[model samples]
Target: MLTQLTISNFAIVKQLELDWRNGMTTITGETGAGKSIAIDALGLCLGDRAVTNVVRPNTKKADLSATFDIKKNKPANTWLSQHDLEGDDECILRRVISSEGRSKAYINGSPVPLTQLKELGRLLINIHGQHDHQLIVKASEQRRLLDNYAKHQNLIDDVSYYAKKWAELTNELERLQTSQAQREAEQQLLQYQVKELDEFSICEGEFETLENDYKKFSNSQSILEDTLTTLELACDNEQFNILDSLRQCVDRLIQYSDIDGDLANVSTIYQDALIQLEDASNDLRHFHERLELDPQQFQVIEERYSNAINLARKHQVSPESLHIKHQELLQALANISGDDSRQEQIFVELDKTKIDYLEAAKRLSDSRSKAAGEISQLITSSIQELNMPHGQFKAHVSTKEGEQLSSHGLDDITFLVSINPGQALEAMHKVASGGELSRISLAMQVILADKVTSPALIFDEVDVGISGPTASMVGDKLKQLAKTTQVICVTHLPQVACKGHQQYFVAKLTDGEHTETTVTELSEQARVKEIARLLAGDKISEHSLANASELLAS
Candidate 1:
């Protein structure tokens, strides 16, 4: 429910602040007292288009704002959370229109796009006025209202689920059908590549290891010769090799061992040296023998390395990556083969899904039609009490074969009205007068209040052209409506004013030479005075005041 409104620099309203109550509130004043300006300001905050002409004279900008209490509005809370805005049961919406035709919108002091503000505004209030009743003539609005009353949650859910499934399955079918030839062609290429790679039977790290081994074998002769020379210098078999010469010297020294003890110890060291030289000579011979290399084997290894590198370059990959490429090609071939089978399945599923969607949609349509009949009867029943004794009301539901299904399902609905008996029940646009439309609109609203979740409803002169008992009925209905949702009405009917939980009088005053709009909340006595003024025009006679008090007391 709207808790407050502030307007500044708007046409004819310099600055006005209004604190609203939770129930029915009535605003009444003399002609041209800027009552409509307040509504316009609220519309601007709700993201209505604005013109520079709406700005006050000599003012650069005009601003309007409204605050709403949201504890009871779960939809609004969810919407705020979805938009990443603060949602603590209170929301403030503000719009500023500049003389230069620039406008800015804010929600809870955070900047927001105009569309977002409009979306949020819709959840808070439904503003119905004389002109807005033309919406009753629209088929879409009638359909929406019927569905809202039908409360077909299960049917709605089923339709939504099947519709989504149909969309997804159909998309898959199209993609597979359109790409079938391409996928087959790709399969051919993938199969060929996979076969070619399998024929090579390449091994991981084989190229690098083989290349290193080949390098070593190619230089085997030089390596072996160097090893032989080093071994021979340490110990060799030819030229007394060190071992035979050392052995003879040690034997000669041993013969004189008895003549010199120190010489005997030297002979033992020479013997040990002879044994080490013989071991080195055997190692030298083994090294020379192992140096043998095959020229043909070296050439084969080189050719194989070249082939691997060439293949790597041709495929734009390293030799080591060939194994990965092989696996990828095989996988691609598998995917291509599966595409045909999956495509057929998807097509079958699409047909089935769409059939299911249409079936659910049909149920929803049937249910809506049934509910629309009952709702029309209820509305018709309310109209007579609203002083339209002869008025005829009808909810027309039409279904054309080719009509598109929307989130709300597939049916065209239009409300028809006949102001008097024997008159044709034409479209609402054709027969509803300003006052009659307001009552009709009010009747529908009253009937549908329990179904609609909006927390606040604003009616702009809904009592226009109505007086007497009918006006009193409208007031009484608004008062009853206040029990559920907040209701505000801009009215000239003193009877309506008398039924309000609160009354505000809008007045125009001049301070020096500047005119400004002012609003004053009426006390009990003052309300009677205002209601009396509304009853007797400019003169407040004792009889009118007494009548006003009696009306208030009642």
Candidate 2:
């Protein structure tokens, strides 16, 4: 759930910090008091498009951030882990918009693209604007919502896979029907390339081995001569070798230890040195015996290494990558061989893939057809309770049997509604009243609440055109939704504002030159006064306070 929000220089809000709690909370104040500031700030953190106007006057930039607790949000934590961004149970998303309209986003303090921020935001918070009903008119949007409600992602994925396969095979079939001469020419070229690489036969990891061996062999003479010279000086010399000199010094030191006190310490050092020199000479003699360098091997290695380099240059690749290129050419050659037979084989495969796509699409269509009716009835029941007792709703799933296949399936889903008893059901956009659309949108959201997996839900003036018991119905719906997740609403209606588990008052403060908007969480006594004000226009009389108190009790 959303845990905290901090805004700096955003719109009229110079600085604000809000600590959010679970369940439904309402924000209410006089008109133009910046009641929507919290929603706007959260949208920016969620990667909403930003412009210079969002920055407060005389401010260089607008900064916004939101924190979410994701310990129980598996999808969010999984996404973070997949992207190497996982941390503690808390996830903080931040955004900074400069006055020049340039913006930057960060997740967990690491700079990220807006696309990533938006993707993560979808899993944390969902903000519903007053005009979201306008988006419900798009058929694509309708389809997405219905699909989410249907919860048959596996069926959808299967249809998509088969549709994609069908497309690939169709394109291949068209290619196979093209000119035969071009195909033959392409085959001949691939054959020649494959033959060249085949003869070279540079196995994996061989390029590095070849280089190492070449370096070792080319310097064999110097390595052997130097080793022999060092061996003779260190141990082979009878009169002046290092081991013999160290031993003589050790014997002299032991003999003079009693004569000088400092010489006693020097005797121990000489003895240790004698031991170390003896061990070093023995190891050197062992290494000298194992050293062997072929006199004629250098020329063979030099030629092979040169040829490898030339092959790499001809192929336009590094010598170390030549083995990978060889494998790629080999696979291409295999794919290009026997074009005529392959074309015939593709014709059969294409038919099978087309059949598979249609079958899977049919299955998905059936699942949607079943889910659509259940959702339609659920929404109808909701709208009837939202002051449209006689309203009718239906999700029409029109499946095209012989039409072109789509990645989503063969169904065209549309939402039809009628807000009056004698009215004919029609498309939502064709209706006249914005208030009716708002109610329908709310009804749909209420029915499909489970589909919105985000931990927090925010409604900005969603009850704009509602009043009386209808506003109370809307509040009931929001509070009911809050049973599963946190709900925050900004509203003017006392009926809705009074239904919150907690309430906040949005107020604008000004002296002369500067103006700022602030949000304060209201106490019990304060809530009564505020609700009374909402009920009776800036006045809190005794009767209004009594009514407010009674409403709170209920």
Candidate 3:
């Protein structure tokens, strides 16, 4: 159950700390007094969207936090343990919204995504909004309510899981089954490509070797000329050649070798350089002798290289990578041929998944049918208590065994109602008036209270448009609801305000420059005044106070 709420700089609230208790707590204020602001703050902490301007004016950020004692909330505690967010006995959910419109959520003290906060919040509290009845028109909402009443989420989940598996299997089968013509065409094209690469039979690294040899033979004349010129400069020159100059320097240095130590080192360096130059000149002459210009060989090698280049270009592969691409094409052809066997396997999977989905969906349908009968009777009795004595309510779960499977299983649930004694049962949206719908929505909540998992339930003006005895009945139901769980109700009716275990009064205060909302837990006398203020005008009177006291006493 929720134990504490702290709100700061949120909307018109400057700062507020509220402690909650286990039982029905009524929050009453005049219209537009911001009675729902605390609820809004709680919603934000529960991971509701943080819209722009949510922060108090001139404030950089808004902070909201809620503390829950999960000692009795096993589901919430289990979730915490699963996420490794467990504490001694408390869980804190917090939301911070910057003035720049960025928001962050935290579990305990660790940051989390908004989705995780919302998921955990669902287990901690259930908020029944004022306009929840408006959603009765939606078929999905109707189905969800019935499922909630059924308390068979495992069945629903199984159905969903099986349905997803079915979809996946069917999709795979279709991918392999559809486009048969295209698949065959692709196979044929791959076969032709493989044949062409096989016939070409270009060996690995063959293209580079062929290209190098062709270039060497084509440029053989220039190669020989350059070789001859280098040899002439180094050793073949008739006079003033580099080799001769080095030889003279060696002899000259040897003469002064004993005269100076540095001169002796120079003599050794000159001698080594001369020997190296002679060796290089001999190697160059040998290379010139071995070189041969074979135009015919060059022409043959050039033709082979050009074909290799053309083949690589045709296949869109580098000449060096052509072999790799050939192997890839071969693998592709093998995979294409194996598709028939793979397709057969997928067909078998589809059949198995279809059977699984049908079984799960059938179980869900049975559960829904049983839950529908049970909840319908409860809702009908509760609606009569809310001043609809002649009203007849039915939760009809129609199962389509012959139709296709859906995520929600084979059931289509409809909330049927007959507001008049002899009227035929019909959908709530088409039959119930706004007042009737509100009462019905309330009755559903009252009946489904114990069926829910949340330990705390908040009702935000769900009794709007209801007054007098109906409002009194609404309050009685809420008070009864608190016997099993904590209930927080924001209401305007004095009848409802008088039925609280604790009462808080909301009011707007302003001095012309700044406006703010404040909530005060009322004392016995203050409670009476606030209830009286709700009954009559803002001006309290003896008669109204007496009436308020009478209501509270009852």
Against the unseen true structure, what C-alpha lDDT does each candidate score?
0.83, 0.87, 0.90
For lDDT, candidate 1 versus 2, the one ahead is 2
Number of clashes recorded per candidate: 0, 0, 0
Residues 307-412 of candidate 2: C-alpha lDDT, one tens digit per residue: 8899899989999999999899888777767667888988898788778988998899899989898999988899899898988888899988654568999999
Model 1: lDDT to the true structure: 0.83
Clashing pairs in 3: none
Question: What clash pairs does model 2 have?
Answer: none
Task: Return the top candidate by lDDT.
Answer: 3
- Between candidates 2 and 3, the one scoring higher on lDDT is 3
Most TM-score-accurate candidate: 3
Those runs of model 3 whose alpha carbons end farther than 4 Å from true positions after fitting are 53-63, 67-113, 168-178, 181-188, 201-301, 331-348, 389-392, 418-424, 550-554
Looking at model 2, which ten-residue stretch has the lowest summed lDDT? 445-454
TM-score: the better of candidates 1 and 2? 2
In terms of lDDT, the poorest run of 10 residues in model 3 is 398-407
Q: If both were scored by lDDT, which would come out higher, candidate 1 or candidate 3? A: 3
Task: Report the lDDT tens digits of candidate 3 across residue range 362-456.
Answer: 88888888888898889899999999999999988887764355788887788899998899999889989898899999988877777875699
Clashing pairs in 1: none
